[model samples]
Target: MINSFEVKETNEMIEKENLDVRTITMGISLLDCIDSDLDKLNENIYNKITRLAKNLVKVGNDIERSYGIPIVNKRISVTPIALVGGSACKTVEDFASIAKTLDQAAKDVGVNLIGGYSAIVSKGMTPAEELLIKSIPLALHTTERVCSSVNVGSTKVGINMDAVKLLGNIILEVANNSKDNDSAECMKLVVFCNAPDDNPFMAGAFHGVTEADAIINVGVSGPGVVKKALESVRGESFEVLCETIKKTAFKVTRVGQLVAKEASKALDIPFGIVDLSLAPTPAVGDSVADILCEIGLEYAGAPGTTAALALLNDQVKKGGIMASSYVGGLSGAFIPVSEDQGMINAVEAGAITIEKLEAMTCVCSVGLDMIAIPGDTKASTISGIIADEMAIGMINQKTTAARLIPAIGKKVGDKVEFGGLFGYAPVMPVNNYSCENFINRGGRIPAPVHSFKN
Candidate 1:
């Protein structure tokens, strides 16, 4: 029902505007893989992932060639390891071994990355979840192509301050573990509030307990396409600007819908949702901030930035939902300072700061993402940042996340190059005022009154 575009137009959009299916992620439920023995659990995970996703990369490549659409990544996600390994992983090392198995499976399957090496502790942590949290630095250090996420807050359950405080130190330790690579391991980790079950992106993607045994989810991104569409409506009325964005987003999501169907058919997996987001890359012209600039901001952190971002985000959802049969994940514009060249340029020009980025996150898809801070910043400060973002998501009842990288041995004046899609970020200064007392208070922040709905 969405075949309202000419083939030439779609190809032009892809050839010129940096449009691509960001990832074709297979969500494999590993609930049945649970076992009492650690070795058996690891073996189950590896065999199941390998068998179910064996053709994932090949199918993605086949679809890319068949349709001439670029599928940037072929990846996999499984049930959160915390629940799967609870009976088997009695020690931190036991959890780290699972990470190794995941890395090996991902390598063998030839996918870009494997997620769901994760824990969901939004309310409180079980003993097994606590061990997973403790093993993060070691697990990340010892493995490649494995991503980890922790959910520390939710609208119904409020903020988990105990888990939040613990992860603050774990984030720093994860960064320290990969300092030689500019702490790039931090790029593979995310701390979430209200994380979604079917998200196809990393490092926050996992097969939620509510999902089916196996499903195919597609992530499609095109900030460049949106930026180009806005250029045609320069100085137009706000209504016209909104309409143009919606139309462009519809087109983008349609592309993703097609790719999702083909991949599902090829892999014999059930079709999941299409996440059509304005997720940017480091390339010039492929930036969410650039779309904002075309929407009349001199820079992304300008005074009117948040309002502009809210408008863009709303219109994108409206159009994408119309095009796709199902739309989920964090389907809007992301504001990662490292991944968007426009954001990186804004940072270099001093047009954006961490505080302003936090404000922007209130309306954006993700929060305080891919931001780098000074190496010497206190862990309590990091906890304070997480608490603030989690509070925003909890009160607003929207999904939000923080992927802060404290680049070890780096300062505010210095920059870090992560290379490839992780890109690079100029270190931003964090507020030096201490919040140690606030962070040390080991209790949950109660959900706001608005969340009392039955």
Candidate 2:
């Protein structure tokens, strides 16, 4: 239990910084559901999820109400289906059916997003993994809440160029197929490098084989809270700001640890990691970009913002590490352009650009998230963006991803609405450079020299 001083400090930080719990993710391992028969596989997946997650929402709600803080999303990430249903499926459509079943199960259990509709082909691709990857467009198009990811690279085995090549086409297909939803369905897809299995955030979360049969992880976000804490210290020295952010993050993460511990106890599932990402919502006051702006930038994406974010990201991790022994996932500030109102406003006002966002990815969580590019953009360009982001993750020994949607027929300055938490974005331009040579290298970019440390 946290002491009164800590709690008081956290509350004060919340009042001044706009901090709150971002998400409470429950991880349900579906590996046990794997069987020779597809029907049995489906039944097992549904039953295991239902049993493990039956009380997830209730526990989250109770925690939120009791703590007087918001638990914005109640999400579930299951084992990657390619691993679970690989031997059972004969066709891509079979995999699609499995995806549908998972989606329906999430709805039945009242969860918002059901992740792990994914394949890990970073080293090589299995037949089932190949089929599932091919079916992502159909699965994501047809299902309401199913999120998918394909891990194309990692530090140990490097990236599989074949898989990387396929993803370029896959994303385009998903974008074209879901055009009616403003390509919002594509928003549910993420391409990752060194992806964590126990992640709880949507579009990227997945239950890994190393997890327990069932576990509940909490992802707490409070960018507003962090920003509020920095407001009065605007004219302070950089070192002072770093210290302030660290102290503030300590309190914010403490709240998350307390809520996750209590919630896990109530659910009777072992406590999983506390993903300390500054996940933003479409809500006006809850924007991560707003937090950046409050830290002295006129808006997110202004010059000097990346340096500020780098310090903030590092300090948050330092504080969070002190606060919890189980801190994991993408534990940093998220700059999803669409979901964050401040980011959206920045893009619209020309204060931020795709190139600057790319640079910011060096020090932040996730990359090119919820960004809209011109529909006419070449597939090679999309692949370049992905490769660039993956390179950052691979080289930095950190988790980074790209969740870009090329809105068909939409160009720069045009607004694409995704509705709800998906939010809206003004289409941003990508460089006109041809990435054919870089992408065609057709082999893994070796892990960074730093990753070779014994």
> Which model scores highest in TM-score?
1
Instruction: Tell me the TM-score of each prediction against the true structure.
Output: 0.99, 0.95
CA-lDDT, candidates in order: 0.93, 0.84
lDDT (Cα, tens digit) per residue for candidate 2, span 116-216? 99999888898999999999999998899899999988776676777787888888999999777677778999999889977878889998988898887
lDDT, model 1, position 236: 100
Poorest 10 consecutive residues of model 2 by lDDT? 10-19
lDDT of 2: 0.84
Tens digits of lDDT, candidate 1, 1-454: 4343557788988899999999999999999999999999999999999999999999999999988899999999989999999999988899999999999999999999999989999999999999999999999999989999999999998999999999989999998888888889999899999999999998899999999999999999999899999999999999999999999999999999999999899888999999987889998889999999999999989999999999999999999999988999889999998998999999999999999999999998979999999988899999999999999999888999999999999999699998888788999999999999999989899988877788
Per-residue error for 224 in candidate 2, Å, reads 0.9
